[model samples]
Target chain A: MRTAFYISDGTALTSEAFGHAMLSLFPMKFKHRTLPFIDSAEKATRCCQQINAAASEDGEKPLIFHTFVNTEIKHIINQSQGISYDFLDHYVEPMEAELGIKAQPKTNRTHGIHQDYNFRIDAVNYTLDNDDGVSTKEYGQADIILIGASRTGKTPTCLYLALQYGIKAANYPITEDDLDNLQLSYDLKMHRHKLFGLTIDVERLQSIRQERRANSRYASLEQCQLEINQIEHLFRQEAIPFLNSTHASVEELAAKIMDEAKLERHRY
Target chain B: MRTAFYISDGTALTSEAFGHAMLSLFPMKFKHRTLPFIDSAEKATRCCQQINAAASEDGEKPLIFHTFVNTEIKHIINQSQGISYDFLDHYVEPMEAELGIKAQPKTNRTHGIHQDYNFRIDAVNYTLDNDDGVSTKEYGQADIILIGASRTGKTPTCLYLALQYGIKAANYPITEDDLDNLQLSYDLKMHRHKLFGLTIDVERLQSIRQERRANSRYASLEQCQLEINQIEHLFRQEAIPFLNSTHASVEELAAKIMDEAKLERHRY
Candidate 1:
């Protein structure tokens, strides 16, 4: 059995992301553990002892991924029995050399409260308030408006964009009424330049809707097929940019939408 | 003026995080650009040309942070007239050395649809359904239940935990009646082991509430003070672990809660 440890002085988000990426490359089962907020030398020392114990008990060296800003804490953890991969140590020097500037090793700055925190909070609120076309009176406030049939992965994508990038994303569900006429809503037409469409395969849409309401007309394959066809036709006729959500994850869809829309990510 | 470019073969989340961390160390205005899904050699070449042009126009080397899985694409982008910091290039070798395995250069694997994707979607659904103590019947399903007075930053923290870590989090608001009685709700008492409390300064709570309802008694300083005092006392009486949310960001609060509650982060 193998063990993987993610350690950091803050939330360990960076270490976790890098560790997961690297670990997924290998074909092995791993017992993942996370030790966050190891900001002090004492905490680091205790964490190292724990890691060493795990290594000895497992009869294999544990893989430790760390992003410690404090040199002292990082040094202590590095002396542990496990094979350590210090994320900051590996890349910060190269970045400094390339940019001709020294990076300030600030702990927790990646997710700390900065000038952009309020912007992120406001974006989340905006996305929640404007979700599912609940309120179109504030369409002008959105950076992008996602239009799609229900169960096309719109709400989660909007929430992801708003939370991750602080982008004010609002979503509107393209109902049967709208799809039948092949016309955009008056509010959506006013903001046509900001519209992005999402369409999914009939089978996937049927399956998703089935989970919500089993054996209903809304979850029927014929209904899903009809809606998808009409939506795609409307998109092509209106010259609106759209993507297929059947194969792409929410993160990919959000990133692609932001790129196609030329929306700037709000720095936080 | 400075330009910071974050490039990647897939979502570019890693590049964006590292670039933002490095840029925050410097106190200067920067025009940040994100270029994601550069999955081909042709796209890489075009991106390098853009970087070179930006460098020449700015009269200073632009900073390019990248995580290209394709070696050829990485080589092409590295040759651009800019300072390049490749996240994967710097760390992959050491990992290979430690693990005795070659890292697979897979694009879009970091945020792909894995087994954990459904877990995250379910967690988000769970959080939304159980938000603001609207439905406590399913407290058994929650990994952690956050309790606080109104405007104590519970909802956002719960959502962050759910979205980022795929943890099923539910939140309860401590109303004036509960505070006056200085007792936990009957439903919450049943799940005492899963309870985590949040407290905020009276002024901060008042300000947050004022934004929702201005000049009302509920948003007044006296009400905030009374509720905070009672809530803290209730928390102490019930032996519930809690944190002050007045100064901590949502990310920090979520991480700390997970740590203190010994809640495992559900990997996605």
Candidate 2:
């Protein structure tokens, strides 16, 4: 198999995202074996061993993508008798020339700007009324409120917006209360302009929710449909902009939101 | 004051990280303001308004580092009057090129054979029993295990390793159970060679934990001290390789881990 690895000496999600993106851009001639992490000599040995075994069995070598960071493992693998792989660092050097301008710094006015933005996103995640004595202000302070039913990729999307962009993105479940009321929270109403809605295909939502709380009322497709319809109606009535979260990756959706909202700019 | 907006029409943290990295590389030469998460036309207007108001007060011009993905926002910003800004898309060209090479598909298997040797390093922040959920029977599966206490910079380190290199990294936290037992899980013990520990300054750990847990028992300095001591002792007893997860940023840590671990080389 033409295996491709998206390995890392650390977390591989981002790399995987990039890798997937790259793969999507290109013709898939190879069987991709994207590994997100390879952290030790032993692990390297095991990978080597597996490759060797695979080679012996198939009477041909399988293509491996070595996305890892440990040098010792590199050395062993480099000196290894067999197996195919590629390292990403060697390929990144050419791109350095594009960053012609040097990065600049922050001043007094920029003091703890990160802290402020982070707090804003956290503020939005907190449920004020029913919070378990934690903090409510953090959730309320969110610059953007994401409303959706459960398993609509709301948390991940909000987190992506918050962690990657440093935007204060808060998400609240369009709970039964909100649905029954046929309206959003008073707090949300006050910040209606900052509200964005995410809707997904019923099947996709059900599958995602299944991974978490399974066969529950919350994960039910019918409930999802009802809530989605109610939420969509509410969004229409309130004139809040919304998107079909289905088929849209977090990156695409975040880009769409930012483009549409023109959220305030900050000196990152 | 010269105000600059780091408008992220996308996720802001990545922009912020890039911004911080850039700022560190090149210190600020002008009065600057960093406004993050400007995701819409109106928000952009509001940001401009704020900047304009500030500029009127200081009689200075503004510079903006707009990190965006929405072509529409770019169009609007391009149309806006008298805003000085640098678009990140113009800068990321080189980085993208390098990523392309690393991610390119290989047609030749002879050379690609030994390329899967690179190992990944994971910087675990909490007490995880195993490296993700990947089983040990899959010995060839893990790249590395980063065992450490909270706020040990595990997440960023892992991310850096993966982003900078193509390594598959999995992290597991060394929880109280692991520490008290003075042993890792049966699965990990079997794959001990893949285990790497990340330690940080107790004070630093306390500070990081404080941000997440607040004034809880876990965030206490004394608790931190005791847990660190226990974990360290356990590491020593097990003869596990380890790193101090303090002072160094993500880039530095990943580089060091790669060098130390001798991660395998990818032939391709």
Best by TM-score: 1
Name the best candidate (by lDDT): 1
Isolated chain B TM-score per model: 0.95, 0.53
List candidate 1 stretches off by more than 4 Å.
Answer: A97-101, B25-29
Docking class of 1: medium
What's the residue-level lDDT of A235 in candidate 1? Answer: 90
Q: Please give, for residues B40-74, the per-residue lDDT of candidate 2 as tens digits.
A: 77877776676667667657544444544555666
What's the true lDDT of residue B142 in model 1?
94
The Cα error of candidate 2 at residue A225, in Å, is 2.7
Write model 2 residue lDDT over A1-268, tens digit each, in one string. 3344444444333334333333432343444443334567887777677656655655555444343445687676555434433323432332233334433322212222343443432432332222221223555566677777765656545544553455667676777877887977776777777788888888877776775678988788887788788888988998989988776545456656765677653334
Worst 10 residues of 1 chain A by lDDT: A86-95
TM-score of chain A of each: 0.94, 0.59
lDDT, candidate 2, residue B92? Answer: 39
Q: Per model, how much of the real contact set is kept?
A: 0.56, 0.10
